[model samples]
Target: MQYEFRPSGVCSSKIVLDVEGDIVRKVQFVGGCSGNSQGIGALVQGMKVDDVIGRLRGIRCGRRNTSCPDQLAQALLLYQSKNETKE
Candidate 1:
């Protein structure tokens, strides 16, 4: 399934990704550092959502306490939870 998240406290305004079973793919971020966001997207593509969360959840943007990557992980977790609840 495809999920789009509008995240808070991040440089990116939104993130869109495709998830199938445990795999996350085609991650795209809007309104952020274009190259970095796309690089992140490519790196996480085909990775498990849980794995992505584990690796990225605690990352901070310098002293701000949260980074765009961390927010993406949160968004994936939120999406997964909502999907599970629906099923």
Candidate 2:
């Protein structure tokens, strides 16, 4: 499955991730700290959704209390919940 997150309170315009079963295949962030986003994407590329959420959910951008990464985690959770309910 492919997931796209449009998060608030961050430099990135959008986040895109591709998942197969429990593993992430590709992650791309648009309009952020280019290098950092790329590195993050690469690092999380093969990780499971739960693992990614665990690692990223609490990350905050300074005092704003939510970063792009955190928002991505939320989005993934929401998406998973919605999909599961359809089954």
Candidate 3:
């Protein structure tokens, strides 16, 4: 499945994800710190969604409430919840 998410309290504007079952196939962040966002995307590829969530959730950017990674995790969680509702 493919998903797009808007991130709050961060430089990034959008997150795009491709996931298959429990694994992440791809992640892309729009309008953020290029290197960090790209690196985060690369690192999370092929990782289990839950693992990514566990690692990335609650991450803060500077003094802000959330970071790009955290937003990505939130996106995945939303994805999981939506999928769960389908079953």
Error of 3 at 49 (Å): 0.3
Candidate 3 local accuracy as lDDT?
A: 0.93
Give the RMSD in angstroms, all C-alphas superposed, for model 1.
0.9
- What candidate 1 gets wrong by more than 4 Å, as runs, is none
Clashes of 3: 0
Model 1 lowest lDDT segment of ten: 58-67
Query: On TM-score, who's better, 1 or 2?
Result: 1
Candidate-wise lDDT, in order: 0.90, 0.84, 0.93
Candidate 1: tens digits of C-alpha lDDT, residues 1-85 = 8889997887899999899988996898999889989999999998999999999897988788888899998998899899899
Q: Please provide, for model 3 over 1-87, each residue's C-alpha lDDT reduced to its tens digit, 9 standing for 90 to 100.
A: 888988888999999999999999999999989999999999999999999999999999888888998999899999999999998
Distance (Å) between predicted and true CA of 77, model 3? Answer: 0.7
Error of 2 at 84 (Å): 0.9
Where is model 2 more than 4 Å wrong at Cα? none
Q: Where is model 2 poorest over a 10-residue stretch in terms of lDDT? A: 75-84
The residue ranges of model 3 lying beyond 4 angstroms of the native Cα positions read: none
lDDT of candidate 1 vs native? 0.90
